[model samples]
Target: MNPYQAPLKDMQFLLENVFDANTTWQNMPAMAEMVDMDTAVAILDEASKISRDLIQPINRNGDEQEVRHEGSKVITPDGFKEAYQQFSDGGWVGLCGEPDFGGMGMPKMLGVLVDEMNYSACNSFTLYSSLTAGAALCINAHATEELKEKYLPNLYSGQWSGAMDMTEPQAGSDLRNIRTKAEPQEDGSYLISGSKIFITGGDHDLTENVIHLVLAKLPNSNGISLFLVPKISVNDDGTLGEPNGVSVGSIEHKMGLKASATCVMNYDNAQGYLVGRVDRGLVCMFTMMNYERLAIGIQGLGSAQGAYQMAADYAKERVQGVAAGGSPTGAAADPIIVHGDVRRMLLTIKSITDAGRALSVFTGKQLDLAKHGEGDVQTKAAKYVGLLTPVSKAFLTDRGLDATIMAQQVFGGHGYIRETGIEQFVRDTRIAQIYEGTNGIQAIDFLGRKVTGDNLATLSQFVAEITAELNELQHVSAEDKSAISTRFDNLLSIASHINDNKLTQPALINASAVDFLDAFGYILYGYYSLLLADKAVGHDDANFTEQKSYVAKFYMEKVLPKADFHLAQVSRGDSAIMDMPAELF
Candidate 1:
């Protein structure tokens, strides 16, 4: 396997050229004094080094060793503890946390880039910190001031790691069905009693403590609420106390992410403090869920980028069939790079991964603006955040799997063997689509709640923005511009059709949701491709500019047509999907 290299050039290009992140940060009051282009570049450089030099070496070995369940504790693979110590000491877990709570308070724009590199280096290792950062974000957002002061600092400092406990044996996506109980106690605490399955980082030896943000029902009510339950209780002076009844039943033997502990966590009347108002746990949890959703999307993007690098590198070295124009190297057999099919696979991965990265960064910018911008800007950014979060989680992972598989195909039989390390990319990325809410659930959320809930107002705003930006680009050709515009038009029309019939059609949204989201993803990628091409026009690196233009052209010609297929499926309504009887199967 080729060594993992963070795409620093592309990251810098997106930050400085396409997104103009410095200007955005300068305008936001909270971030204006905290970060800028120089700081972001420095952070990215350091992150690249950490990913390539520190975390990547353990990826394959971690997978092979896997996490072990020894009696009551979970032991991570060799090198995980040391690597995590280095990671935490660098203050990386708090890169985007609030400064008041010992966080660096960087913008999400910079944070997302850093996350991609770490994930590219090692998915299993990166997940431990990712959950920690996300749990801190949630506590900072909704937890009381006392709670924040007590826990946020430790979490941000990485002395304590965090986990999210939401799923149960019977309840996966539907939180309403959870049977976890939190009974009120006399001392202003609750007794949390339940077992949560598939809990990532639930109980790991990586940190001094594991703080869990748990979801449970209040006494005598079906209303769900969020709580902060610690593995080890904390005293008033912030000293560690006795065990808090939080125990690991066992670690799940999973398909991938073996090094990251997935536990069956049992809270035996675990002493807990409410993070938010009663019966509103789901709402508060969304704060963390949204963050994890975008992070998971980046997980997919990072995997795809890593896989592409390996494939592209291999294609150049592997000698295979002759080129259509004959061998340029005059060898017995030209490199596989000369073959059209190999090029097609490589280009497919390149086009999608590049666009996906730009989109992830774009989503990150919205998250920053939503948190730090003024009234209208904040409100608008929040709406866009809600609209794009699910798309980012679903579409990016969907394409990520596609890219990884294609990259593996480039290796032929060699890809299937574990020694090559390409199959690890495939196994690791597969979970991104499954966890952090499955892609199917994400699609339903996108089309059902986000788009149709507002009667298309927010989506219309997004469409108008894309259209205006496309028209303003000076480098794109009219033909290219028209092709994207037509898809945009078709998207709105299809959305309007769904809106007009959803109430009467009942099953329409559920049946058409996936296709609609897929269509939007394709159209959005097409838009970003052109935007990147336009921004790359006069870049100091002429080769980089040409590559961007080539990818954009390829996306428009070869990939954008997928929008039509999905749009057609959306036009068919729910009749075909809902026609079959359940018993017939």
Candidate 2:
């Protein structure tokens, strides 16, 4: 079997059973008649085939060939350009875009699932497409109608790609410090001039033109403004023209996802149009960022899934140590999966990845609700979506890196070899945690912004909802309910303690944010496993139910314990982090 199989059944279960995504779409008038189970399943299957057959073959090769920079131009690896053409031709770029702008108008939930599958097959190759989707989403929401009419169709169609240019030499995470400048010209256009670093898809030949959404400070503005700068200037007739002032100075050779073109973009008097109002650029940029943050989370999900596939396959085939029952009588050696430690590692990967998928789907559904649902339903759902975004981004990516590392460990010596592809998973997964606002920053956002700033109302409401779900499961048989309920309570108690204590130290809260993220992730996974178990009960498929039950039990017993450790540290407050002097470090 191919190593990158889509896990179609599992994805279907998540969309239909766990999230009831079909019903969610059905309720929304905008999406109601547009999508259904059959259509969704078909889309997923096609995306899976493209990912497995077209994209997967390029995964290792892309990493090996990387992106070569000669003078000013970048040479994408062999087959990359063709693969991108296939992707574009399939209209995959606009899978969830607006129909008015030539998109298929699918639900975001389905889009996320497709993205996860693509990322799993090959992260580097998938990024080019993912960023285009994100950039188009921003333009669709915030840009003027003229801009939308002119740019959206091409962007959605993948005839053109988009890149975000925010980070400068002086500004890494602090956007307030950006030095890029945009001067208004007599022709109502802006002359954007600055150097942007680490701009993914900055300059690539994959598409006809690269639309860059750059953040620059204007002379009259107090903060910053966003501008649309394309690689090649476009005429009023919608035809490509002379080269825009922007050029790729060079590309960064990264630790992983080598095929992804991380470039140093130089915008010297780049002909640009301002996106949104001048002072409100950051707000407009965040419209795209919220989506990117979630997409980055899915990146982690993909890495974890990919790593699990490699590890699971290795464990079943590699025979090393004897089984506990004395080599099964006449067997030469038992499969490594027979050992408890290996089982623990595999179970951890399964439990977290499964829950991560649920969380991603849940977030996607919330976005749908926020966008389409009515009145209070929309208001409440939108708040929940905002609250979960940081958690989903930070938590999923953090766990993804750990899960990938664990999967690598299962391969032991083989994992170190590039042939196994496990090391690449580790290297690739590591970036997810760092990017999309370093997981630490994400933690700070969760606690300082989401939890403390909001007086834990959002976090409390989330916990309340999960608690209510657990309460429902309590009515089940004692044996069936024990693991989930107990673990749920443990998770709830810690959250309550944090809320009740009213911890206010940002440093301490930030330090413990990652731990808090893990604790919440395990609890969330336990919730998902319980949901799966609840659905699997009395089903004729023993294999499905048995696997569900075993994984849930392992999660509650082995994974849930970490919540206590995290709470213990969180209880210590910020002194451990805040008390240390910067000079001392």
Candidate 3:
């Protein structure tokens, strides 16, 4: 049997029951008319069918037949181009774009669910469009009116694709070391030169033109700048012209996600136009970076969901052990689902995945509010988004990789084989931890910038909110509340210690950042799962409500305890990481 199934019911429960996205939309003017329960459900249904029916079938094939490069042109797998067109034709590309630019302008909350579905179906296939969504966000936020008018419509329609060109050989994470140069010309455009590596969808035959948001250091500029470098130069009338001086050097052969093209692009005197302000390329790129970071987290969520479906299904059918209740009368042995350890593995995957999805969707709601809410509300939402962005990026992806690995173990030797498909999940999920800024960098951003850096007001507010909820739950029996409350206190104490010590040393902050990220993520997920339980209490669906309560208890007892362990490590500071000599490795 195919190991893929759309978790539509669970997704709907999270959206309508836990979050009440419908009510949230009713309160927001910008999204009120555009999204309702019916529309949201319809969108989800269409996305699921497209993902399961169309995308999942090609997943293994795409991986097997990886993108091939011959001479200057690169070729996608047989069905990719047509599938991309189908995705575009269905208007799926603009699920969350601005309506003014020929997009549906749906709320990001809904968009994120669609993203998770698509990723779960086929991460490599979904990335081609994901990059477009991200690049469009950057352009819409920072580009000029003409640039927006000219490009946003086609981009939103998916008639044209987008790529973000930031990395070079020497400048993967360090933007300052980039050697790509943009020389200003008399026609108000800059001539871009240098090579960019690991450019996803860099040069594909999927669309008419590929819009590259290139990052290069311009001469006589104070710092790096962003440029819009298209594959084919366009005239003022929006007609295609000669080829821009950009070419694909080659594509990389990687461990997984081979369906997606990872190209090394060479720009030799390519005509380009500055995107944002001079020397403000980093700032503009960050607009895309922030969104992409969260999207990567969703990628993790997708991988976990995909892996869990396979493992859970296998456990329910494969008979290898005796049941706790006793051996089945007619069967050779009971299914592995009856085994405590196997159940533990599956539950671990489910509990973490469910919480991860809630956290990600919550963040997506914050993104929507930040963009469309009122003055102070918008500012507060924006700050909250900033604070949670890194945690979601690092912790979710890290857990996603872990979860997939555990799920693979469920299949035993079958998982190791290419035919079983579990190994692909492991490979596809692993990259989420490394890309979009390695989880290490994400942790540093969470601790140093979000927590330690004078942004304490936002962090404090978040803690107070969670504390209030914990206090309310305290009325429950002491035994019931102990794990939950202790986890909350542990997280609060760590945040308080970080604030109190005021460690100005970057080294210390950098070293302990991953611990901080893990602590924050676990505590945050615990809080969200508690909220889910609260919402699930009154529902008439006994099975669903009971599942929610069980997951909440599991999170408090099993998952939340990790916060204390992380805090203990964080309190020890960065000496262990810093004191290690380079030669010791």
Q: Which candidate should be chosen as best, given TM-score against the real structure?
A: 1
* Residue-by-residue lDDT tens digits, candidate 3, 1-585: 464677887788888987789988988999999999899999999999998988888898998899999988889998999999999989888779889998898998888889998999899999989999988999999999999998888888999999999999999877788999999999899999999999999988889999999999888665999999999998899889999999999999998889899999999999998898999999999988878888999999999999999998988888896777788666668888888888778888898998899888889999998989988888988998999899888888999998899999998898899988889989998889988898998888888888878646778788777677656753234554555566656666776777766656557777788988898787777777777777777677788878878887877778787888888898887677788799998
Residue-level lDDT tens digits of model 2 in 15-34? 87667888888889999878
In model 1, what is the error at residue 560, expressed in angstroms? 0.8
RMSD of 2: 2.1
All models: lDDT? 0.93, 0.84, 0.86
TM-scores of the candidates in the order shown: 0.99, 0.96, 0.96
Q: For candidate 3, what is the total of clashing residue pairs?
A: 0
Error of 3 at 200 (Å): 1.1
Going through the candidates in order, what is the number of backbone clashes in each? 0, 1, 0
Question: Which pairs of residues collide in candidate 3?
Answer: none
Evaluate model 3: give its TM-score. 0.96
Pairs clashing within candidate 1: none
Across 185-255, the per-residue lDDT of candidate 1 in tens digits comes to 99999999999999999998999899999999987888999999999999999999999999999999988
